[model samples]
Target: MEWTGARYADKPTVEVRTWVNATPERVWAIVSDVSLMPDMSDELQAVQWVDGDRPAVGGKFVGRSRHESFGEWSTTSHVIEYEPGRTFAWAVADLDRPSAIWRFRLSPKDSGTQLSEWMQMGPGRSGLSYAIDAMPEKEQKIVFVRMREFEQNMATTLAHIKKLAES
Candidate 1:
């Protein structure tokens, strides 16, 4: 991802995609299972369903994350979109004005699947907001650094998923 000098209010986003040598159904099975994410992610520590056992548009989940710089924190995410074998998305903190939004999209390509993981941070307040508030002059720099971290992490996640799906 290229630097945009984004600020928290800009709602910066980062996405990473990979072609998996597996069917969309196979990829969907993995992506939709939030329980599997903590293992694939570096910052995410755990995830548990709050309302239901499986993915649903109105369901909720709590995710525990730990960042070396920011420390550990948890967030409740509401599932905003759920389309079997195609898309899965959730909004963190608030349904109407989320602090973050995350998504997974899958599409058939050739004999495999094209899978994408995307996330957008903040039109609403979040932990990062505290950092920005403390260093108001460096808001853009902070946002840029965080966005890059997300980009790298998302790429690692996709690579892990690709390995799992292709195996």
Candidate 2:
């Protein structure tokens, strides 16, 4: 099966935002720790240490998560950019698709810290990714649905982190 790009039902991209009642440093502590993701995110089941320093630019890690129909999926991320208490980004690779990117940004605010995550799929290409994309429109919708789920999961994670930091 070949999943041509046409499978997408023209759904708008998904984005979610959440704020934490902790300083950037505090938030960074939780986000930068790749080993703790499974404990933080409701969707992400586990993260295995791949390489590189904690949250440092060039760091690599693999994470596993479950989607509605996909069951369990794994993706690896490489830290392309890192700024202490400001911004951190990861270019995801070696999964169902090769051209996906996930990034996280941290900004300080009067209340605490603002954290955001974003992901983009396709255009890069991989045999498996293309094969999966070949499925029907409903299958294509899973990715978007997961993105939204991640947002809410992340929001809850942030809220927990906030409580931990404030404590």
Candidate 3:
């Protein structure tokens, strides 16, 4: 990914996509299973449903993650979007002012599925905000670096989902 020079208040985002040799239904099965995420993600250590057993609009889940710079932390995320085979999204922390928003989108492509994972950093405070607050002058660099990390992690996650769906 290229430098974006984004700031936290800008709600900077990153996305990664891949074409999976499987139906949208197949891809959706994997993407909607929040419990499966920890295995596919580099920083996510665990995830558990907080309200319901399955994905649904308004349902909630908790995710535990670990980052070299920020250490380990957990956050409650509320499902903001859910469309069986098309889209799934959740907002971390406050829904009206989320620290982050994450989503998965799927579309039929030829005989397979086009899948994309997207995330927005913030419109609210998060662990990274502390780092930025500590070095106000380097906010841009901090946001850029974090976005890059998210880009890389999202790509790896998509690759894993593709492998699982295609198999």
Candidate 4:
């Protein structure tokens, strides 16, 4: 991700994909369980369903994340898209006005499933915006570094999911 001077308006995204030697059902089982996400992520420390027992659209969840540079924070996310064995997506913070959108997609392969994890940064206020506001001159650099961090973390997350699904 080269510098595009991406700001909140740019809504930049980072995605990582991998093929797992498992059925779509198997992969979906792992991805749908938001509670398991922390075990697969670098920044996320925990997640809990807010009021619903299932991953249906409109359901909410709270996630706690710890970042080395940014510190720890929590956010409530609303399930925006939920299709069992195919896709799961959520919007962080306000559903009508999200700070970010995150998704997990699964597709059937010959003997396995292709799984992808993707996330798009905000077009609204978020932790990043606070940092940018404090150091307006280095906005591009800050966004770039954060995007890279997201990329690496997403890749690691995919790898962990693949391992779990295959085993």
Q: Which digits, one per residue and each the tens of the lDDT, describe model 4 over residues 1-167?
A: 65557766788898988999999999999999999999988899999998665799989999999988789999999999999999999999987779999999999998999999899998767888889999987788888888889889989888888899889
Clashes of each: 0, 2, 0, 0
lDDT by residue (38-109, candidate 2, tens digit) is 777766799876754467777788888775555677877778778877777676674333455666688887
User: Which segments of candidate 2 are over 4 A away from where they belong?
Assistant: 1-13, 51-53, 94-99, 125-134, 137-140
Q: In candidate 4, residue 105 scores what lDDT?
A: 97
Instruction: For candidate 1, write residues 35-126 as lDDT tens digits.
Output: 99999999999999985656999999999999999999999999999999999999999998899999999999999999999999988899
Instruction: State model 1's lDDT.
Output: 0.92
Query: Model 4 segments beyond 4 Å from truth?
Result: 1-3
Task: Give RMSD (Å) of candidate 3 vs. truth.
Answer: 2.3
Error of 4 at 129 (Å): 0.9
Can you write out model 3's per-residue Cα lDDT over 39-116, one digit (the tens) per residue? 999899999998565689999999999998999999999999999999999999999999999999999999999999
At residue 12, give the lDDT of candidate 2: 26
